[model samples]
Target: MKLTYGITDKLFVWFFIIVLIFFGTILVFYIDLQHIVKISANIVNKNNEISAASKKMIENLLSMEENEKKYRLLGKDDYLNYFDTARKDFEGQLKKIVQMEARGMAISDNWKNLYESYLNISPRLRDLKKAQPSKIPWIPVNVINEWIEKIYIARAENEYEVYLATTELNRRGQTSARNGLIGIGVSSMVGLLGIIFLAYTTLRPLRELLKGIRSISQDRFSEPIRIRSKDEFGELAGAFNEMSVRLKEEEQMRSDFVSMLSHEIRTPLTSIGESVNMIAEEVMGPVNDRQRKFLEIASSEIGRIGNLLNHLMQVSRLASSAIKIRPLSIGTSAFVSECIHGMAPAAEAKRIKIEAEIPPGIPNMMADPEHLKQVFINLLGNAVKFSPTKSKVKVLIEEDEAGTDLMFSISDKGPGIQEEEQSLIFNKYYQARRIRGHMDGVGLGLYISKHIVEAHGGTLWVESKIGQGSTFGFSLPTAGK
Candidate 1:
């Protein structure tokens, strides 16, 4: 029900489509070229033929004048006949020049005017010669010469016009060819880039999907799908990633439940076992000095059981979202120092020197003081428990921009946690098994601290080096209305 394509396939499709457009454009230009060339050639040929006819008309008109002069001087009929023949030839050519003007073939306005003037005078002069030959014997010859001069002027104008038309036609033809070539070039480049872009968009998701599959095979389900697209492939990747996360969460919850249950049952049963052993040994049988000691040890073990149960209950309540937080203004620096001091007895027993470095003018934070105190006390207590004898435990406070907030850092000079275990440190009941026998409490201090800090709109995390020491820090919001 879904369609997906790789980058190369997408690119190929785009390129193929572009090729179609390019070829279509080339065909269009080819047809345009053919039409332009045909029209241009026709215009040039027509102009050249008109020029030739105009030049022949001028020659014939001059010849007619020469013959008329000879006939007038000698009174010869043969010369008169020659003059008539040349005259008829000139008139026929002149008519053709007029027709060229009517057809819109590069004829000038001045040329048309001159031709009109010659046509009007020629007929009138011929009639005058026939009626008054004795008084104006050479009138026809004079009119012929005048007409020839006018015809020459008109022909010259027409020739110049034709030359201009020819030049312009060539210029326009060249421009059209150049534009067509440029269009072809630009379209081809655009299509190529479009293909490349389409291809990259298609292929990147497939690569990401493959990499995700490999990571899943290695039992790593934390990497979420990062591909952002509107296609079916993107939707599939997102769905698969969501499923992976849900499964991982379910599996982790199952493991945590089993481990916590075992620990809960074992702790109480151990306390009851120890108490029953003390009674069976007859240590408290007579209810004397040894009896008192046995009762004391049993009481202490019972208290330990109660503490363990309380911690388990706290984790369950926090995980199930049963706790509600009420925020109030409290001095951050003072509170942090007090929590550190409260753990002084434990540090003193380990011979660890505890110190607080609270700066002046620290901001007050908005949070539940009791919850924040529990967070700080748990961190400080862990520092005291793990620090080597005579080693120093330091607490530092500072603030910065982005909002008024408090940063409390507790550092301990003890064997630091391994890098591989750092990420799981805040997970519920995730104790470092290697150091479990050396400590007296379950590994819920940091987990509970993380929950409380987050509930107060803060963050908690740890930084450590294997050989040097470990630092636990948290951020709390500044005081506000």
Candidate 2:
């Protein structure tokens, strides 16, 4: 069994993937930031505590030195007591510094040895001072000064360590920021690619469906839409294909019926036309003026029916691709003149002037003479039929700009076709809305003429605007000189 993945399913999957990538990047960054913060905080806090303890030790050593100086000058027991007290306070601060060094502070070995020697000498120095009342040794005082200098050095080193820790923290912060920007950029690129993929998948099938609909509208029922997906559009395409097949079958049935009907009616109409023509010509007996007039009307009506039947037969033959053309080379000027002369009677009834612009030295075209004449007659007849009285109908023939084809155009001063309907005018049985009730044709003239032109490797087109008159034109390849 094949899995049917719809557009909704695809959208959900892509959304989930994008969300996962975004959050995964954020989580990794959070872990890295926490690690950096922990390490930096430990280093900075330890260095700050060591710095504070070293400052207190320096003050205690200075007091010890001051009290010893008083004992040597005045020789008092109270001064000795003050010296002992300051010594003990200094010992307490030294112990604290040792403890911090064991944890992580980087105190120098020289500083530690100096601290131990000062502790060992301080008690003996006090006793000797009591024993000898007037004399005091200068050696223990010098040792105390050296210890004070060591404390200052340790404090400066601790402050420097603090600065180094702060700098490391800032560097880590910048690195995290850069990594975050890279992560965001990657996520956005992935999201944009996902959006483009989704749009292409969705719109491709819709475009194919639209194209198929347009083809069907133009009477093409054989082209099927091919969408290779297990989605709603696929189902719709299957149904559309079925509908096209049914429409093609129905169209064939209709064409066959029209062809059969036209054939059955044409034989009787031909016989009746002959009988009416004979009566109008008075071949059977002499007739009065009134009788002759009625006979003439009957003859004309019969002839019109015959022409209508002939048109129906021609349309059927064209549809079946059974109309074969015999190509011949004809003089361009003379042939166009003959068509114009044939249409002159109809134009005269409306007092419309028919003008021709056949430039000298126009080349002859390769086309079926009979079928080509029919095309010209159909075009000219439409012009004469639609033009108002005293209006001018113009015919122009010339070589196209490429110098390889002949272009013929018929222009009429009639109510023109609308722009929207111009493309649809050549379709079978498609009558212009404005001329539907007023026009006499069943809209087959242009349709048949278009096919006839196309059979000879040519194209027919119209240019028109509402109330501005219409020009119908066609191009035919010329016979090479």
| Top-lDDT candidate index | 2
Worst 10 residues of 1 by lDDT: 128-137
Q: After superposition, how far is residue 438 of candidate 2 from its true place, in Å?
A: 2.2
lDDT of each: 0.73, 0.82
Give one clash count per candidate, in the order shown.
Answer: 0, 0
Residue 254 alpha-carbon offset, candidate 2, angstroms: 1.3
Candidate 2 lDDT over 1-481, as tens digits, reads: 9899788898888888878877877887897789788767666566666677677777777777887778778878787777767767777767876766777656766568866886677666556545666554433666767887777777777777778777877877887887788778877887888889878878898898888887766544558888878778788889888988888788788888888998899888888888877877789988889998998888888877778878888988987889898878888899999999998889999999999999999998889999999999999999898888899999999897888899999999899998888878887788999988977888888989999999999999999877879999999988873
Cand. 2 TM to true fold: 0.80
Q: Any runs in candidate 2 off by more than 4 Å, and if so which? A: 48-175, 282-295
For model 1, the stretches where C-alpha displacement exceeds 4 angstroms are 1-21, 35-232, 241-245, 248-256, 259-270, 273-315, 326-335, 345-352, 359-370, 381-392, 398-405, 411-447, 461-471, 477-481
In candidate 2, which residue pairs clash?
none
The TM-score leader among the candidates is 2
Question: Cα deviation in Å at residue 77, candidate 1?
Answer: 26
Q: What TM-score would each prediction reach against the true structure? A: 0.52, 0.80
Total clashes, candidate 2? 0
